[model samples]
Target: MRIIRTPASIYLFSISVIGLLFFTFLIKIPQHSDWIVMFALSGSILLLNYYTILIPPKGNSLSMDSSIYLASIFLFGLHSTLLVLLIYSVIFAIIQRKIAWWKHLFNFSVYSLMIICSYYAFILIDGFTGPISVKNIIPYLLSICTYFSLNLLLVGVYFVLEATENIINFFKEILKETTATYISTLVLSLVLVILMKPNHLFGLSLFTVIAFLLSLAFKQHFNLFKEISEKANKDFLTGLNNHGYFKEILEKEVTAAKENEQPLCVVIMDIDDFKKYNDLYGHIQGDHLLQEFGSLLKASSDAANYIVARYGGEEFSIIMPNTDRKTAYSFMNELRKKVNDTYYKGVEGLPYGCLSFSSGIAECEKETYSVSELLNKADQAMYAAKNQGKNLVQLYNGHSEYSVQRSLSLEKELEEAEFQLKIFLSKDVYTYRHSKRVYQYAVDFSRMLNLSVDERKTLILGALVHDIGKIEIPRDILNKKGSLDPHEWEFMKKHVTYGKDIISTNKKLEDLIPLVELHHERYDGNGYPYGLAGKSIPKLARILCVIDSFDAMTTERPYQKTKTFQEAIAELRHCSGKQFDPQFIEPFIAMIKEFETSGDEQHKEVAASIVN
Candidate 1:
């Protein structure tokens, strides 16, 4: 036999076993008096079951079958309740042939279990045997409590196992919808059970009519609740989730990412010159444009399983899960190009000459583990995109450095940095590798320190050639794996001055000279060449000191033992006030923490086991 032993199947089998065990307790079949009462109650349950109002993608539906079960139990006990529901469910299953066989079995078993648990609870609580009396309130309360508790537990377990979701959070989410329904079911059950004890036929008939009316009321109430929820979550104009709901989902996604060690990306977008387009077209057409863009975003996002929302007027966000930053950048930019090419009448009249937008992207693994931090980075990237030019997609690269207004010229400058590092490779291969490592560390740390776009550009480029002057020293001395003598050490110390002089020759690259010269300066004023100390050290240079030493500790060197990332961070913390600037330690720690868990190719094998 082909056996399916998945979580769903196992759960169904377990519950079915319990239900079958409950059936064994149905030995005491009721007499004529029970049948007379059960006949009307059975009909009521069957009719109510057929008229259930369903919730989407689930079996959470509104039905008055609980009152029938309660009334039957109060009248003739567990055996009668089981007998009534068994016949009704079988017919219900056959009538609704669309339901799978296992589902039908599961449904029947759930009801059987509920009745079993509730009946025993009622009896155990000293419930009266004969008539429904005020003194039997304890049993009624306990029974109602057991029924809902069992229902929640059985379904909750199935969902938790089937979906692999958090147990506590799943309960909280379901409670929002199911809490009131359970309360109403218990109250209605109590009323019907009491009335039926006096006259079975009349009470059952009255309850049936009352249940039909209640169903109508519940259907209307549920409809209204859903409508209200829609309005609250969605924007009035664009129909996208509003900013409030966006934050809600962002927080949830952050939690999920942290729990699963998965990556999440946030794409923040703003329509370029939208106000001008709106001004030229008027608010009526402007609203239409917003609607059109929202529709475009919704359609584009829906198929990708992204949560697209209107962050505010003219601004929007797309939250993507299990996506890397590189993939997210491509996706957002492709959409940006599509929007630019797609024509809106008045959009062409704006400066960009189309429906263009600026977008910023940030991923969870990029020093932005929290929702607020991710939003801030993504938002900054979006504005950086605007500053560079509209119709651009910018990934938050620690600092806003990549948003170079003069990117064509910036490209030329990058070639120079690469050229300097390349030339040094011939003289000392280790300096080449060391510079590269320092540059990469600065990239992550620059973002953590929130350096401005210009400063980040300078730091990244400077770190690349900070050791270029070491090329002038003898190759034998550079490659020596022992401590440097006095003459060799003095000669090596002159590299900073040599690098500064080399960088000063090019006006475009001159901003990096301070970083090249002052990176070795100490807070306590005992650094090389010049005894520059404290605030006297350039800010960029001070920032570079922490990162440079971090890279040195991480990578193998001729003199010092290469330290783990943790050891290096400790070294930085221990020397904070004396050697390194105290202000940069914490942010550097944050950046290193990001690198430890990051999936970035650079993070996999740092010269630096890392920190606590």
Candidate 2:
């Protein structure tokens, strides 16, 4: 016969034993006596047994034994039966190690022998000591205490063994199959026993058998549910929470935040131009990139409070609770940088020589809006990033009066400027194309250097209008066929300050002024404008300097033919740390290579010309 080593089996067995003893006591009440005390005692015993079994007490078995003894003293009388029971129980426990058969036999023999011994001892003691009634009462009370104590000891041992087995099984399978099954079986058997004839021995036997079966069923069902839940929540590709489960958790967190008055921030991110990347590199490589990006997010964020989820295809979101905007921004910035730094094999010419993404962040404020509104705001911010340019971060403060007015004013101005700028660039088609190309290069190079999205956006916008200063110079001078004289060169350099002045008055475009003014500043403090060098130059200006210069050199102008991509990169390499920030040069070169091979040659060529 197979020996049951499972916790469910032990728990069921112990419960059955306790139930049987209590049932026997209930049935043995004399017909004439009030059944109320016995009924109350039975109820108390059942409750105590349930408590012990359900939440077994901590520490040694002795405490459980004492409790059992106390309960027994109220029921059975003191006699030799108690001693006999205790001795048999100890002996049976020792010998019933291997087989269930022997253990059951020991259990039966111990209880039966103790009962018989108590009856005989009570008779003998009564005859020797005094009147039967008084003498018998003391012996009967003693026997009752001993019987309960021994029963409690047996039950406690069984409970401990079952609990240990269940814990072991839980570790082994992770799914609580045995536990669920046991619970279901126990509940069903208990209900049936309560409804059945209490005096019938068959009812008692049937209850024990049914309870054991119920326990096994409960464990199996619990394991099944656990397996299903794991499959439902886990992402197959990256082993992270899937989008559906992530949303579920986010909703819960949102409700919790509302109740507790805590702030919550959500960040949504997507790989910029991922479709182009996938088209260039195959789906397998694309999948690999997604997996890598997910892993990077997981590693960078705090696992305790942050929920990182695969929001969708090539998109991910992090839900942070109890975090303010500034901290949320910093956390996202770090995550972005870490992702940009990740290396991939065979892929080059993209930002970081592998992949890059754009992000939008929104924080929940007290009384601002609902969770849905926060999510919508984050989505809008993300789209704004895509609109401004990719590979950036956009934060949504959400529906401020000042911002709404500012946005409306900027929208009108941008539309007008876009029209005029288009006309101006078309008049000299090369100028418009060149500016656009340089903007791309600047954006890519800045990302490669791990610059913040705000900085990258500034660099790209600066690059687009970097030569806007040239608009003021005569067209003949701007596209001059021969090298400029010192006087003409002086006139050309004025475009930097001119462009800066043009954007300085516009509040929306004010941030772009520093880029325009300082893009020409050299690393050695030798360039134009303020001649700021080294750390004095804004890092954004340093990135713009290399990108613009490379675009100017590689693209064709009236005075010069286009240089090869390699030639442009080599020129930038030689000037590292002197004309450009030394740190940015390698990444810049890597970005150029990535773009060139990835069929973004037109953009690269246009950038080269603008730089020159």
Candidate 3:
């Protein structure tokens, strides 16, 4: 059978075996009675120390080492061993002054004094009764008291010194040095036992051996426990944190946030169209994508208070304690763009041109709530994003009529556009693709302006079909190689009226004609058609004008060189409030700056190409 090796068990076994051997020798002593009593008492003290070490009482203030010393002192009589203990205590006290040395000294002194007084009282009683003499009684009492008092002081000092010595040695040796010191200490104690003869200093030798072995075993057990804990808490796949560990930490953070009345934000993200990618590719590629996404999350939020966890499967959760809603929303927006921009070229047939993810964010309030509630809110938001159209971000702020309407509108448009663009682009590929880019930018800028559902949908569809009239403009004029002359320029302007006329035929699209027609209208009222000025221009039209110009400036035009997204935005800003409504321009510019600063080149490029 395997022995259950523990510090206390090992120490007890050693003491038991040693005591049996000492018992045999103790019976042969000439002063058998006195020696037997001494041996028995010593054995009892050792047994008591072993019991305390194995099953220590709860709330016990004494350490195992201190208990061992106390046991040793109790076993040895004050008359014979008092001086030795006193000297050791003094030395120990001087060496270790920080471990409540004064308290130990006082306790020892009081106990020793009590023992001395008791011994004298017994002598005085004997003297008054019969054979005891008073002549030596006073001197004996004084000598015994002095001896025990000194011993108590030394014992106190030893405890202080030992504690201090351990601390100092630990710092000097470092972790690597501990093993050598332990081995050396064991070997030295064994050598000393052998040289001094265990039969002579049997009690001291046995105690030393038991203490050393027990300490070593205990240390090993603790180390094993620590190693297991670290492995259990760490995530094997992402190297961030496992789900179980994340939950534990999140609970603690949430509790802290609530107690401190601070804000805590959580973001839940999942790969968009992940199942499609998996079906198209293999599980191996899916795993690789997950790993890449995890790495990106880690790199993006390395702040001390930020935590990222792989909640499970393809979902990840981020916790930002003490972060307000606005800040958290901004962070999630940037994170969404980053996830969308992450590309894996090895995968095939992805529409967004890469692996993309949708994110939902929820912030915690001081009201009684749990971390799970926050996570659930984020999950709901993520589903909302996916439902509206994948690869977007949604902030959960409870339910609202406006939010519901917007979600429905976005869903309808996504489905319709996916089908319509396929047919339209197949006929005239350039016009179809350009219209898609314009729609995307229009939607983005509309959301940035916090437009209502009706306004956003109007802008989205109007921009998408704004150039639909080009189909009738004659291919030569539409794709003209040089600048348009007077007659051609006038004909070019006819597409707006043509687009309006076509859109007006559909009741659903009738409201969008104004937007389509006025997209060419300038902020300064210097534009074509009506020349509507300032607020007189339809809000959607004013927005479309800027986005349309931006898309044209950045895209390769028939007669103009394509400009970078930044350059196009800069040119737009130069004409803000003149060519664009000043109110919308600030938010637009802010959104552009945010996108650029996010370090997502693809998103910036996408925004620039579509808006120009």
Best by lDDT: 1
**lDDT to native, each model:** 0.80, 0.61, 0.62
Comparison by lDDT, 1 against 2, better one: 1
Model 3: per-residue Cα lDDT at residue 562: 94
Q: What's the TM for model 1?
A: 0.63
Ranking by TM-score: 1, 2, 3
**Candidates ranked by lDDT, best first?**
1, 3, 2
- lDDT per residue for candidate 2 within 456-564, as digits (tens), equals 5556666777666666777777778978888988998998888877776665676566677778889998998777668656666677788788877877887777889
Error of 1 at 412 (Å): 30
User: Could you list the CA RMSD of all candidates, in the order they appear?
Assistant: 15.7, 24.9, 27.0
lDDT of 2: 0.61
lDDT of 2 at 322: 88
| lDDT, candidate 3, 1-612, per-residue tens | 988776544443443354334333322323222444344334433343343322111112112323322222232323322333343445556655776854545544544443334334434534221122345355334433443344334444344444433433344433343334333433332333243332435645565566556555655555676567757877778777888988898898887786566788888888777788888888888888788888888988785358998888888888898897788888877877766666675544776776677888888765323465577668767877888777787888645343455446555655554464455444456566677778777777877776766567667877887877665576677677879889988998988888777666765455566776777888788997878677556677788887788778877778788999788878888998788877776677676677678864654455356335
Q: Is candidate 1 or 2 superior in TM-score?
A: 1
Highest TM-score, which number?
Answer: 1
Give the TM-score (vs. native) of candidate 2: 0.37
